[model samples]
Each structure stands twice: as structure tokens, then as C-alpha cells.
Target: MLADLRLITVQEYHRMAEAGILDADERVELIDGYILKMAAKGTAHASAVTRTEQLLRQLLGNRALLRFQDPIRLNNYSEPEPDIAVVQIDPLDYADHHPTASEVYLVIEVADSSFQKGCGLKAKAYARSHIADYWVLDVAERKLHVFRSPSQDGYQTETVLREDATISPLQFPNAIAIIRDLLPKLRAE
Candidate 1:
């Protein structure tokens, strides 16, 4: 016999958080109406995220709002907290709500243990939301996976850049980031 699983909406997810059902320290995101526990950040992953955050801030400056490890409301059933989100500058600083797909210029996820999910489910969700630019910093391989031209099925364009390569956001073409600069240097064994 098949079992039925109930899926919660984004609204319900928020309500659960507000109601103390989901603690503040709980690292979870609503994905496809399911609460997905985010992977614990390792030293390398944390370092990479910090480095990427710094680089993005330096390059974007006042041109965009850079949010780190914050929720971007994708749809009614999904609200994934990406590692770095390049958003439109809002005077109110998005006090009333999280950045939506339209407000977001780029979403970046720094992946160590979550590489598969980052490039698979996360990518699909972002693309389905019509997010134009999505990037996954693969910590294990030390590469940058860039996804663009979103369609309902998935991103139409996918590119992988090595450490020696550089990439710039489609919105801010002048501000470039070397792939290596945004990643954590592997320690010498």
C-alpha cells in the first residue's frame, strides 16, 4: 500500500517557525513543501562562504544588496536559504518580506556536503522560480557551476568554471570575480 505524505505550504512553514515549532537554531528550508534540513557547514564550506561574501560585497558595493544565508521566497511551496543572494537595493532593506525571484539578481550556494542537492534539487527549484542567475560553488572540486536562462523544466544554460576562470553576474557585467578568489584554498597534505 502507498502512504500519503502531507506537504506544508510556505505560509505554514513560516507559521511553524513563528510558533516555536521550528527553533531559531534549526537550519532548515522549505523545499517542495518539505522541510529539508540544511547540511552543517564544515570548515572549508564556512570559509568559502565568507570569502564569497566578501568578494561579492567588494564587487557589487552599493550597486546591489548582498544577503548571506538568508531565505529567498521562491514560491508558495519553496523558500530555500541560499548562501549568497544579490538583490535589488531596497531602502527599507526588505524589512517586510524576503527577497523574491524578481528582486534577486543572483543566488549563490557554497556547497561542500550538499553539492549534489545544490546542483540538483536546489538548482531546479531556483530555475523553476525563474531566477535568472544561479551559482553553485562546489567546494570538493573547487569549481563554480553557473546556471542561467531559467525555464520551468530547468536552467537552459549551464557552465562550469575552474579556479583559473573568472565570472561576472549578468546584471553587473563589469564586476568580475575570479573563481579561485571565492573558494577556500585546499590545505597541503
Candidate 2:
């Protein structure tokens, strides 16, 4: 990191948006104090996100609130919109502010083209926030990368589950998610 590099705080980021410096339709997120452009979502990415959201909704049934591509407050310097965010239901539905780390149950990133960023920078960011649980769905490989046991260094436990495997959020053990259900079915060529 450059010693002299300026880092933008979350407040400044919001101010930039409110001032129209950052357009509402811009595909960018504040990460480690820098605004990073997000990768374009392809069909596989969109489908996987939809499938995961739909299945989680069906299984969770209001036990948790799910937000797709919505910003989650990680810290003063970083706010990223995970592909799917499983959060605690608030009476206000977070109308006043975005869900913070403590309010989040699970953060899922569909890795269509940003797998490295998801498992790397984002992982560290989430771990540092003590978010508890993070998942990266590798659409191309048809695998689910689970990150748990968050620490300042990053997730202590990392597991890669194939489509045939299953998982459940640490917060809601009863709401099990079959890995296959979260991924798009492979179409025959």
C-alpha cells in the first residue's frame, strides 16, 4: 500500500453518493477505502444468485431477511454488496441504514468473475468485521466455498463443497442449504 495514499471513509463515500459524484447506477463498491468497480454479472452469476436467494427464502421463510446485491456495512472504510446477504430481520427492515456486520448472519458472494477478490480482499474485510460467516459460490466450478471462524487474519476454516454437498448457516442450523440447490443445474450440451 502506498504510504501517502488517501483513504476515503464510509461517511465520505455516502457524501459522494449524495452529492451525485457517484451515480446511483454505478457498479462500484467501497473496499479498503478505495472505490472498486464490480465485475459484470453474467447469466451464470445471475442464475446462481437467484437460485440461492429463492432456495434460501423457501427454507428460511422469514426466519431471516435476504438481500441481493445490497450493501452491508463492514466498517468505516469498507462497504460491499454481497451477492446475497442473509441477515436478521429488523422491524424497520433496515430502512434507515444498511445492515451492519453484527446484524448480518451470512454473506454470500457469487464468484462468476470475482472469485479471487471475493475470497481474498472481501474475505479479509468480512473477517476483520467479525461477520462470522461468508460463502463464495464458484459458478464455473459448481462448488461452494464456505468461510467460517472469522479472525483478523481472515477465516480460519475454509471448506469447498461440491454441488452434491450441503451446508447450513451457523446462526440457523435448521435452515440447511443443499449445495446443488444454490447452484444452477448444469445443462447438457
lDDT of 2: 0.92
lDDT (10s digit) by residue, model 2, range 75-179: 899999889999999999999999999999999999988999999999999999998989999998989999999998999999999988989999889988789
Q: Go through the candidates in order and give each one's C-alpha lDDT.
A: 0.92, 0.92
Query: What's the residue-level lDDT of 109 in candidate 2?
Result: 97
Question: What is the Cα-based lDDT of residue 10 in candidate 2?
Answer: 93
Candidate 2 local lDDT, residue 169: 90
Off by over 4 Å in 2: none
Q: For candidate 1, what is the lDDT?
A: 0.92
Which candidate's TM-score is highest? 2
Worst 10 residues of 2 by lDDT: 180-189
